[model samples]
Target: MNKQQTETMQNTLAQNKNLLQNEQTLVNKQVGLNINKNSENLDDLLEFVKKETQTFKDISARGSSYVSIVKSENGTRFVINKATNEKLGYPTEIYIGYKDEHLMIFNAEGMAVNKLTVRQTKNKITIYNTKLVDEIINHFGIDFSEITSKSFAEGYFENKGREILYVKLL
Candidate 1:
């Protein structure tokens, strides 16, 4: 081939090589971006799965013998589980008192102070007192709007020769 024709051929080959390199660089960048996006999505999915697993474990680990405070638009109710009610001999009347951040449930047979009537069922004993519930909420500094109910474990003990079923607030 003539010198001019040969030089033209070399230039064309160089231009083609440069174009190929540019195309490869673009492809590499696109692949890198896809990998980063997929990694972020995977992290989000794993976090969601972890939260769901923890919720399931919490629900499954709860015990039946517990005291619960339930709130509603009408009022609030304190509930004692069947095991606790049986332990207390299923009293129709109880005296509810609070001191030192502890909720005290006393048998009403020998007590005459702040007697509260309670409803007893096969599964639970329920006490309904709106004022008492409000006082507890205020004392505990609890967010009433965020919580619908809370449960606690109880201890039966004797204080000053009196048997009491008490729940310590958190």
Candidate 2:
């Protein structure tokens, strides 16, 4: 080969080598970042598991009057603790009414036209309804997207000889 052609080939080979080295460096950095991110995710998962285990133990130990609001992809659930459920007469069917940032649960036997079925477990009574929860959240201007669950203290009152249990949302 001519000297000029030999020089040109050398330059091309150097440029190719540089490009390959740069690409390898970038790949190495990406791999390191991915490893660090995965470690962080594992740590977060472990922490969450520990927290939930402790919460379950605490709930099991207490028979308290409270309302827990839980949000999931399927819908929102209002869970009444066992003590509160007993106070509400262990309702098989319930009427949920919302007004002024308060949700009231009343026994539905011969009392209300609109009613929701109650899902009773040993520790709690759960009522699931999507629209009512959505309306209450929207009306109260509550941003519940980042929140998974919340608990509120319950209050009891009687009106027109009807018993009602209520939780005020803030």
Candidate 3:
């Protein structure tokens, strides 16, 4: 191979290594978050996140790093960092379980009043809850609808080393 091509390959490898390292740092932070497993605290946590997002508007921007709290259908709660332009992947259900349905949207102010519509393809699961999504948009008072479930799933898969939380059964 030409010297130029070899240099280009080396550069690409270095970039990938950097991305992997950044992702690993994010994963470690996520794993270290202290989230309460009890359902009762869900509201409090949701409220705190809502308030934090509002208070830290600049930090909450899309391009900025922020914390994302997610609770799956099986009631597992975890906090992850929203890094870069990439959306995080689907919750651990896709890998840890074989069924799809029932993803609960938690709102501290008791505002997630909607039904979930689950759509599953070979490697992805998209859950759409219009009311819930709307509530989130309204709660955060921002237009983040562009970040769809599909995008999150894509992001999740692309960032291979990131941790995916699977909530323990109560």
Candidate 4:
């Protein structure tokens, strides 16, 4: 072959090789993205299954001392029913204050005489004083399982119609 023709053929081959490598890289990247997308879809499906299968907790207390324990795919929380605006019979804002590792419960009027607190772990809920828990359960008619069967546990008291306060014992 002529020298010029040989050089031209070499350049064409090199360009083809470069193009093929670039295409391969793109294909590999697309494969990786597909795998990640599949895993993300699987994660979403798993969460949906968990939420559908799990049962939320509902506990009723007596004399404006109702509590609802709720859990979802996201997390768990305790709700005080009587603290709602409907139960309050007026518009009020709940205030929270921290004192000696206990949460001071208050409303628009003033601080409550009986301070309530809760200690929750991954599987258990413990009130600062068992007596308070018992009083709520006995006098106020609060009903809750001694041990939670779910992945997370929570307990709280209602401050206002929409204000649920939690105590920090940790």
Candidate 5:
């Protein structure tokens, strides 16, 4: 090709490359929007599942207590580990929490209490084996109620003259 024509062609190719890059950026942004939507939906489902549920823990770890809470308006900028001044869940605004490994379930007001267990008014479901119940409920990728209890091994033992229940989660 002539030198002038070659220069013109190179310029055209460079412009096309720039155009392609811009198009790719736009596509990436579109994908980001879709991802945000799906993440919100997943968070909604997680909230529904965890609502009004109680967790039980054996606190031999000498850890403190923690409570994670989501605010009403924003889905990002959550206050995680507030007692430790640690802020997390910033982008989605979901509530995250950390305790000092003391092993306990908490209520909305943040106490070592299970607000929903029928048999555990004493803050421990050691007798009725709610550990197994919670483990079964937390299983992923299947209908929790449909899973046979034999899928997991449930165990029992005595602790300080009290029955302690144990289960292998997942």
Candidate 6:
């Protein structure tokens, strides 16, 4: 192998490692976060983030870092209105991917309306709101009791040494 190629591979691997580490850290923090809509003002919560946490960045098609902005709200902290970004009649959902690659679908306030996951295919990268997906799947099997219908559909399953809450249906 050429030296240049070797160096390139090493650099790629290092970046991947950093991304994984940063993502894991963010996940740990997310577990401790109060993600209730109609709760608090996002501006103040973001201020807390600025004071108590350090932001990490990455280079990816999805995003390099999260862009936190004050939504068009007066003073409420929890705003999860998907229709806020309506152009004509489209209720386009705007989500924010956090430092740990955890996708949060908010309604406009800082409150977390839903969660998303990042997945990779052979030639494509996709993201989806997991909570919505779960809701659909659950509705289809409404007759079944909680977590007893499907083995793979168990929201509380321990997968990959972590508790997976939902899956992105893409």
The top-ranked prediction according to TM-score is 1
Tens-digit lDDT track of model 1 for 1-170: 99999999999999999999788778756644223433524444445444643322233125553577878776698788887777666877777777776777766756667787787877588777778777777886656587788777633344444457776654
Which regions of candidate 3 fall more than 4 Å away from where they truly are?
1-117, 144-170
Query: 14-39 in candidate 2: lDDT tens per residue?
Result: 99999997887797566442234335
Instruction: Report every candidate's CA lDDT.
Output: 0.68, 0.68, 0.36, 0.42, 0.33, 0.36
Off by over 4 Å in 2: 1-65, 73-75
lDDT of 2: 0.68
- What TM-score does structure 1 among the candidates reach? 0.55
Note each model's CA RMSD in angstroms: 23.0, 20.7, 15.0, 18.8, 19.3, 19.3
Clashes of each: 0, 0, 1, 4, 6, 7
Give the local distance difference test score of model 5.
0.33
- Clashing residue pairs, candidate 3? 89-156
User: Could you give me the TM-score of model 5 versus the true structure?
Assistant: 0.20
Give the per-residue lDDT of model 5 (tens digit) for 1-170.
Answer: 99999999999999999999788779756644223433524444335434843345443222232322221222211111322222211111111122231122222222243333222222321213344334424432224344332222221222322222222222
Residue 47 in model 2: shift from native, Å? 44
Q: Clash pairs of candidate 2?
A: none
Angstrom error of the Cα, residue 1, model 2: value is 99
> Global lDDT for candidate 3?
0.36
Candidate 6 lDDT trough over 10 residues, lowest sum:
149-158
- Model 3 lDDT per residue over 19-45, tens place: 997887786567454445464345555
